[model samples]
Target chain A: MLEIKGLKAKVEGKEILHGIDLAVPAGEVHAIMGPNGSGKSTLGYVLAGREGYEVTDGQALFKGRDILALEPEERAAAGLFLAFQYPVELPGVTNATFLKSALNAVRKARGEGELDAMQFLKRVRGIMKSLGMAEDMLKRGVNVGFSGGEKKRNEILQMAVLEPRLAVLDETDSGLDIDAMRIVADGVNALRGPGRAMLVITHYQRLLDYIVPDRVHVLMGGRIVRSGGPELARELEQKGYGSLPAAA
Target chain B: MARTAQTSRVTAPAPALAAQLARYAGLKDRLAGAGLPWLRDLREAAAQALAANGLPTPRTEAWRFTNLRPLHDLSFAEPVALVGSEAERAALALLPALGRWRAVLVDGRFRADLSELDGLPEGLAVQPLASALHAGAAGLDGLLGTLARPDQEPMAALNTALMEDGVIVRVAPGVKVAERLEVVSIASAPAERAIAFHPRLLVTLGADASLILVDTALGAGAAAYLNNPVAEVDLAPGASLDHVRVQDEGPAALHLATVYARVAERARYESFTLSLGARLARNEVHVTLAGADGDCSVHGAYLAHGQRHIDNTSIIRHAAPACRSRQVYKGVLKDQSHGVFQGKIEVDQIAQKTDGYQMNQAILLSPEAEVNSKPQLEIYADDVKCSHGATVGELDEAQLFYLRSRGVPAEEARAILVQAFFGDALEQVPDEGLREALSALIAGWWEREGGAG
Candidate 1:
């Protein structure tokens, strides 16, 4: 469902992602385990088509179409979602209102009927309840005062509502407690199905225990150094990424 | 010969304008015979002071931020007759009705027929100024110029000199009015040329009494009308008030307003001003905490689109010990619009434990948009907590990207962010319906403004 060829990205005239090539097929979960400053968030931002991240030289194809030229909203409408590592606080716009407007925007792009207030409320409340968020949070401003764990959970709730074709979770397990990690992993696990793909980026292997990935790739120095199965994650947890052989 | 004509034009004095000033000078003696003897001396002094200083020039420090080049050539006649037909009155009546007590001022004249004040509780007197003058009340003149300063703004002084009838509401001691007092001032030219009108209002709440005042202004046509309004509020010991001033004048109107308020011991004063109109408008609000343990909240929102210019200058003085004050003003300027906010908090040496916070934020929508913000704090007390912050910037690119990445359109995203920027000021409004309507009006203006460069 997603393909990348020598993805070289630069921010502020300095190259960050140098010659990164990766691919993920449908119905498969891939975990990109990397150290800090290994261009983990940069890959997620590049895939989500965020502004200011100049594509120096690369080709990113989603559903067999070049997506580097698309705007962020256009990429979102074409079924690409990026669960941010840190959610932005919008102090006046409510969570429910923001979600509904977003959903309607995507629906309109798909030529679908818009949801009214009641319908939208019902939809968001259901997802929010499953995510263990209070009903009052929907009325308050979006992530204005939410804690670190709650922010991540809110991102997951958005992912559930958007139901995009390709989901990229950037360090989603950074600030979660054990229980929240399990719940977030379960939410991602529930969305697993045919013709859908997910790319989970994390520094720890603990999240893989809940939503086991079909493949684990060791990333260091801006490139995937090694690719292996689920056992590779357990080995890394026992030892560390330092014990792995360096890629030539 | 051309040089001679040019010299004549430069040396020629505007005798007609001078005659207008002379006519204004003679009104004091006429007012002395009209009763209100205490007001006559102040009126005469104000007239004399204005004649000496003339009108304010752009070079003046107080008027430095606002240029009156457009109003320099404006030729205004004396107040015209109120010109709203039966249909016009009916059309205007359908607009938003303020709280319970409604006082209507049409074309600078007080309309008692359109107002309803049937059962004001005992000791609460809501009457016209002319009536108050006729009643020989000894307290009328003592409190008249106590709040509104004359020499501060030329327009304010002019309004004081040529003022007609206005509303007077006084709450008895220990009595609180359950409903808000709504003062609606509507301006209609009906005539071909432009004119000027001044409305003066005085509200006094006795010890332990409280009330809310909402001032709204509206006008029509491209008439060069000037709305120079002054509202004076007196809060006795332990009195509280929630005042909201909404100014939505016409595009061609020039509005200058002043709100002067004094808080007694343990009194609480909360004020919010919304300036959303006029080609050029300046609102000056002065609040003083005279007694101990007083609290004040001053909030404002100025939404100026097109070529409109809106300026708000506020001063909150903490004179007594152990008083608190807060001020927040936000502006959204689009097109070639301009906005200015100048706020200052002064704490005396004896005013210990004074807590004051002032913040001003402006969002410029276009490259041509401009905002000038100055938040000043003059504190002389050692045991005081005072801070002021000012920020001028475009919308957050990261926040915009986050919203758009969720499928929200670019326009809707910008509108939401702008509304959020204004949400703090809107939240201070006591009326929900008016708040929502103002939000809708902001959205409508954004839509009509198209894309912001």
Candidate 2:
């Protein structure tokens, strides 16, 4: 569903992600574990077409189409989602409006009919109920004054509502407690199906226990040094990245 | 003029101001209520004060950052020369259709044909200034020239000297007006010539009375005319008045509006200004909390695009003990437009336990867009709570990216952010329908301006 080869990205005129190569098939979940300042978040940002994350030499393809050439909104219309680690607060825009616009934009891009107010409310209410989010959350400003756990959960709610074919979770569990992390994981796990792919980026292994990944890749020094299965996450959690042998 | 630097030193009036005085001299005899000795003395007094202090300019202390050179470049046709055609009148009748009691003024002339004052309630009265200026008009004893000081505000003095016609709104004591009252003023000029008009609005609420006033200023054509209005509002004890000012003129029009409000004991004066259109405009509001426990809120949002210049200047004075005042203003400037906000809160010596807050913020959408924000607080009472803040900034990049990544188009995202920036001030509108109307107007402006492009 997603492929990246020779993905060399730079931020502020300095190269961050050097020669990254990865592929995730449909219906699969891939986890990238790295220490602090390991270019994991940079990879997510670069793929999401965020400004200032310059790509010197790379091409990221989603569903066999080059996504590096698209704008951030255009990339989202092409079924790409990036769940931010620290979601910015929109002071006056209600979450319902934001979600409706996003959902309609994506649906329009996919040649599907847009959801009216009643249909949108029904679909969103069902999803929010499953995610255990308060119904009034739709009335409040987008991420304004939301707790850390609530923010992460809000991100998941958006992912569920938009139903992106591929979602890039950028450190979604950074500030979440055990219960919150499980809720986010459950939300993500519910979206897993044969037509969707997810790239989960995290610094710790606790989140992996809930939404167990199909493959694990160790990102260190701006390169993927090792690739293995679910046990690799536990192994690194026990031994730590410092003791792991480099296999790049 | 609470925060204005007046009376300490004097400078010669500007050429533009002198020319206006000359125009006033030419039209003094034709002014309203000329035969009335009190009105004549009041006009002369204001004219003398205006000659001394002159009109505000870019060089004026508090009037810096706004250029009035455009006013000097155009010759103004007097209000008497302007005659609206049936087509023009028809076009204007569609303006104040908010489904309430409305009074429409075309170039300072009260249009009884277009006004919706038939089914007014018993305690409420709306009349033309001509009627109020006629003989046997007993209500204009102290309410006409009391609040709006001609000596302090030159534009108001100009209005006082040349005031032709406007609406006089009054509510009886202990009467509550359940419906909102609207006064709409439209400016137009003869072919190929710019025009200027000065209208006076008198509002007085008796003890325990309450009313909502929507005062709107709009233009007719693309002529570079000037719409200057002076409003005097007197609120008795325990009275409440909500004043909403909407200034949306033509592209080449200049709108200068002044409002003076006096709040008595336990009374409240709440004003929300939405300055959307004009070539060069300034909306100045002065409020005095006269009696104890009176409160006032001066809040607004100014949207300037397409090289337009808009200014919002206000001064709120706390005269009695335990009065409260708050000023909140936000502005958005795009293209090469400019915006200015100067708000001051003053607490007098005997006004102990006074609580005041002021905030001014602006967002510049382009590199060439400019903003000048000044928030001032002067306190003489020791036991008072007062604070002020100002901010001038561009949109946050991270916020934009966050919105764009959520599938909103770039322009839609920018419009949303700008509207959000203006939300704090718009929330001050006390009525829900009026608030929604203002928000819809802002959205229309955004779309008209090509949505942040």
- Among the numbered candidates, top lDDT falls to 2
Clashes per candidate (backbone, < 3 Å):
0, 0
**lDDT tens digits by residue: candidate 1, B1-453:** 999999985455334335436656665555322556557766666665666655666667777778866656777766565554673475366556667778878766688877777777677788777566666755776777777777666666776777767788788888877777788877775457777777888889889988877778777545678788888989999998888877877788988888888998899899888877788998888899999999998888888888889989889999999999989998888889999888999999989999999988998888899988878889889999999999999888888989998988888899889888888778877668667866776666667654655
Q: Per-residue CA lDDT of candidate 2, range B1-453, in tens? A: 743556433555666777788877886776667777777788888888889877777777867877778886776777655454674575575563653788988888788877789899988999999766865457685667888888878889988877878899999999999989999887765457787888999999999999999988887777788888999999999999999988988888889889999999999999999999889999999999999999999999989888899999999999999998989998888999999889898889999999999998888889999988888888899999999999899888998899899888888888888888888788899898898889888988888984645
Q: Per-prediction TM-score, please? A: 0.90, 0.96
For model 1, how many clashes?
0
Worst 10 residues of 2 chain B by lDDT: B2-11
Candidate 1 chain B lowest-lDDT run of ten? B11-20
CA deviation > 4 Å runs, candidate 2: A245-248, B1-15, B80-87, B90-96, B450-452
lDDT of 2 by residue, A7-43 (tens): 9989999998889999999999999999999899999
**Alpha-carbon local distance difference test for all models:** 0.82, 0.88
